[model samples]
Target: MLTEEEKNAGLVGRIIPINIEEQMKTAYIDYSMSVIVSRALPDVRDGLKPVHRRILYDMSAELNLSSDKPTRKSARIVGDVLGKFHPHGDSSVYDAMVRLAQEWSMRYPLVDGQGNFGSMDGDSPAAMRYTEARMKKITDEVMADIEKETIDWTLNFDDTIPEPTVLPTKIPLLLVNGASGIAVGMATNMAPHNLCEVVDACCAYIDNPEIECEELLQYVKGPDFPTGGLIYGYDGVREALLTGRGRVMMRARTEIEHTASGRECIVITEIPYMVNKAEMIKKIADLINDKKIEGISYINDESDRNGLRIIIILKQDAVASVVLNTLYKNTPLQTSFAVNNIALVKGRPMLLNLRELIRHFVEHRHDVVVRRTRFDLRKAEERLHIVQGLLIAQDNIDEIVHIIRSSQTPDAAKERMMERFGLSDLQSAAIIDMRLRALTGLERGKLDAEREELEKRIAYFREVLASRDEQMRVIREELIEMKEKYGDERRTEIIYASEEFNPEDFYADEDMVITMSHMGYIKRTPLAEYRTQHRGGVGVKGSATRDEDFIEHIYVASMHATMMFFTEKGRCYWLKVYDIPEGTRSSKGRAIQNLI
Candidate 1:
């Protein structure tokens, strides 16, 4: 809307003004799209970002180092991927590769490292030069048929090489080994699951696509962390599997036992996922010194190559179970994992729940299988053509030989054979160049047998390529085979302990006297603790009081009852009677306000 006067004022020579807010919004949107698409999020089909896929593809295609091959130095693979495909920092590439090699980080590690790749104690991995890595045996399921044009490819950073947009993975990589990434304005933290369970659920879905997530949960129970612990509730797990996000609570597996000195000790056998052992120990020590925790005498880390053993010694007379609960409340013994199952679907970020994720993987597998079958059928048909040509030449070898001998040159013989025998150029050329032994009846039979086998294989491949059911069957078969070979038991044990071991579950149902004294003292004593006496005789002290206070209120209740206390200001506090302090006839009770 500028006039000729503004244009003449030197505003036309790149000094034109635009709305700063609009430009900022446009730039931010562009950057966010870039991050979500090309940088942070993983593809739903392959469950890997560009860098991870590029590293694997570079190892498989460029270096030709498969699972069976000898491991190469990590630096070589990182340098190749950076210079060729991922044009990023070497440290980023190395860090990603190291995570793939870490068993503690991934439930099913994609790379097998020969040297130290770090530990659950927050140790740093060795330098890329010091560590050698190769693809795991299971990675073959992802890399299989990648060379058969089953997946799409794009130009590398320099355009000198081509990299796969996604791998043709048969295994459900997303579920087996979950993903975590932070992009612009969004992030993802998917929980890992058991391979066998996932495969079972996949088979079930293939059999019945109408099965919902709740039904699928029967086969696939919940997340299985590599460093095994215990999941407390199933509600969160169910919510996460049904919806796209939920928060599941996890706790360390600890065993408490009484020593010869009559002291209880906690032996930590396994910790929650991703909780640093050294850091956790240091934190507990700090809490003990700060007097934020009671009953912990000392902590000693007895971890070694054999296994992890963290010993937490307790002071004498400390309630072991109570102390355990306190630790769970105060320390990192219990943690919550947020499940945000977000991934890129067709270059767009999508929040997918369990069922949709499985469906996507199934669809991807179908395409890969179809493409591979087509490739196989094409090659089979070509070989079938050549074998049929040889069979035709064998049927009339003497005549062909006479024609060849009479001809002046090989080209003339080829042309004569093509014209007289109605053979195509390829068939005619193959006949002329046929081996001498191939003229014998035995060789003829061998060629015929090969042709027959190729026909059968071609028919099968065609059937698979034509039928969707056949493709799904192939997927199921591969899944079962993978389960037989590489599947492991679930590591993270999901316990309905919250439903089973509540505050009242530890005690039996019994009548009790709930008493509140005038001095604000409250206690619960079993009715059986009282003895029968004469009506006017002096009875036992109802509750021992120090401030000349008497029992002002009394109520008969069960030990499993819930008691609510109302304050003068109408503030309410409630607790189970089992949580109330037990008092004897001669003991002064605890203050109700303090107890509540």
Candidate 2:
């Protein structure tokens, strides 16, 4: 509604008409793009979201929290981040910071924390005020040559300070540490990989950018989780590497042990990635209380700082393999990790497969190396110019000293030196600022040696900048150096087969004799228990039976062989030889009806 006076002033048409639907569509898209590009997804180059990048930058650049320095309070770090770069809540920033330090979360922890960060049992970390953190030694690689202007910078939230758009990390952090996040209508869930494997793959890619994903797989077998579990098969890993999306089955590492009381127990040493230990134990307890699983007698979590250990005691009559399989079927001990490698590339979300990921990292390193070399080359040239000026002064020491003494002011002396030697302002100033001791014989020799080294470096830097091959060689060398410094063995194991696990796979095949009596008693005894003896030795008892129920049937079969039973009432039952009750030569056996 326009006012009458405004209408008289011919302002009636100021309120332009537009479709409400169109406005909403436009606004919603704008907001969605904001979340997708600016907040959620990690940049493919550095493998970090905005908040993570901001925190690292503030710690490294603003606070100088290097690995060698004393740790600073996490609250102080969060405060600086919120005030300078990120304007979000303090909790979000603190959580991200804590994750960087938690070994369970990060394949290679970026921050070295001095207090409790978190645990695999899903415990929350202490408050920011109670914790202290400094950057890890590996994190120094991320901030390497940052001051050399190897990457772009953008203004912070309030435009008061500038921050890096992406870290010029030397390593393929995207693959080495992985990333996960959710944004408008899209999400990313990448799995961490072994540093050595990733570095090897990266070097191979730099040698040949046309390398296929299959070749890359030879280097990186699969995701090497920080928690160290077993990956059931490689098919999902292959698919994810080729197409950037797939799910891999993960199972806890366990072994069967016989207790002193003759009962069997299953011992779990490591669990799947990101699964909470305490919650998993609780789920197992609930399943037991609900009678969903019956073989276990009790469960105990004996995990400690040394490693993860969970003991599950089984009943005397329980089959260890069956109970273990049941647990896997019903509990988080067996889980699937979906790999969706979506990340930001040039401010747009893109799904990156293995080769694309390697290519992006190589290209980024190429850029950083070029920029760093150029920066170094410039500084070297500037120093070379000043050194040339000094060498000239040394050669004409008497004349130079005479000019300085004759000039009325330092400004006049600089002008006269520049005019006489055809030197630039920088070189002239260097000559004017030179100390008397710098003109000594030893100092002059050092100046000559430095100039010669600078010349060689300048030439090499120029060659690297002009030749792509040289740049790649440099990238390869740096990756190898980093690998030698930090690479370690893969913790997670990958099985090549895709078949579902069968409980029978855990059993061994052996010759056994099955004996049955007229009273429906059945038992299996290993053939080895009846070894041939000398003529004077007595034979072992074949079966202990009642006088009314003598042995009526005897059969020999392998432990894995299946047996079918037929009754006169037209009923049939089948069982594996290993599943039959085992008894000593003099012991009575279990009833056949109970097993069948």
Estimated TM-score per prediction? 0.84, 0.85
Q: Candidate 1's C-alpha lDDT?
A: 0.88
* Candidate 1: worst-modelled 10 consecutive residues by lDDT: 499-508
Per-candidate Cα lDDT values, in order, are 0.88, 0.91
Pairing residues by index, what is the TM-score of model 1? 0.84
Which whole-number lDDT from 0 to 100 does residue 438 have in model 1?
Answer: 85
304 Cα displacement, candidate 1 (Å): 1.5
Name the best candidate (by TM-score). Answer: 2
Q: How many residue pairs clash in each candidate?
A: 0, 0
lDDT of 2 at 251: 93
lDDT tens digits, residues 242-290, model 1?
9989998999999997667878899999999889989999999999999
